[model samples]
Target: MNLSFKKPSVDTCSKCDRINMKLKYAFVDQATNLKTLKEHQEAFKAAYEEKKANKQLAQSSEVVAVITFDLQQCLPTTYLQTNVAFYKRQLWTFNLTIHDLKTNKAFCYMWPECEGNRGANDIASCLYDFIINQLPNLHPNAKKLIMFSDSCFGQNKNSIVTTMLMLVTRLSPQLQFIEHKFLVPGHTHMEADTDHALIERIYTCQEIGTN
Candidate 1:
């Protein structure tokens, strides 16, 4: 054996050297492509300014009232048993509307049943009738009508609910049904103070056994 050991041959490792060079170039390119702090700051400032302007505009405009409806099954309780004996549960739909003082606009509609005797479609029709007939009569000078309701099978189904909605629209052209701009999800509490109180009081008074 030779006393001196030869160093690993660089000639045989040319491919590895090339790969390392390529990786170095790639890293440098990636670093150069990254956004600078000044650029990021400018973008963030622009976005913040835009949002602030939008907030100011929204604040300036008048906020309108929103109407909503909820359906509940009036079960034949001990008190109501005498009057409502035949049915195990009586389905009652509540229509509520709230008027915004600032905008002078009104929104009204009926709530869809989550799980009960009343299907989503039935509640939707009730709401449509109230909107087309009742709303205009209630607020003659209202600039716009905003109706809100829950998403339930009867409300969102295509077969019957869509047809009913279309028919309603045709029947009453004055009451335009804006589909996409309905009530905010999970925000009925905001309008409940105005609409829900009166409706509940009336229903309570009109209970089967109540005088």
Candidate 2:
């Protein structure tokens, strides 16, 4: 008699479940109020469901890798003063977060701008770097790519971004198709927004000094 062996299954998380330590700290303040706690719970549940859905879709080997990205308007280092003799021009911080649905991870990149420029080319450069260099290693099995961004003409919704995406398909035989989608001008709630919220929370706390 011949016996066949099958390996025992090991459970693995579809995505990293590590909560941001800073975000958790912020949540502690919200937990103090009953109404705020309820709101937080609802938002948390919605976010979890979204992540779970993305994970399930990505399990299929042939699934297209969805890249959702957005450029945040540069933030000033310090709060603006109404009447200051110094006339300090605030330093700018450029932020972008690309969330890959296949990996269920958001890769954040921040650039401090001494040159004071945040144009379409700047956004394109960061995105192209990810597609050409980082994405292959992140999701090698990907066959198609879909990108989502807000309809900001100066940054994402212009011809330059469209042209770059077309060029990306030619970079690899494995990437057969690429498409870009714009969320309606008003309604966009994705991973990138969550990242921005975290940053804002940290910034606000720093500005107000946590009691």
TM-score leader = 2
Residue pairs clashing, model 1 = 65-100, 67-107, 69-111, 120-154, 121-154
Question: Per-residue lDDT tens digits of candidate 2, residues 1-211?
Answer: 7988877332322121122333355465433454544454565566456545544566665546777888765777674535672486777788888988776677877788975456788788788888888888877877877777767889898888778878888887567887777654434556677777777768867876763
The deviation in Å at residue 176 for candidate 2 is 1.5
The digit string of per-residue lDDT tens for model 1 on 6-85 reads 68321322333444565567666544334343344455455445434433443354332235444433322233535445
Pull out the clashing pairs in model 2. Answer: none
Best by lDDT: 2
By summed lDDT, the worst window of 10 consecutive residues in model 1 runs over 180-189
Each model's lDDT: 0.46, 0.69
* Global lDDT of model 1: 0.46
Q: In the order shown, what is each candidate's alpha-carbon RMSD?
A: 22.2, 14.6
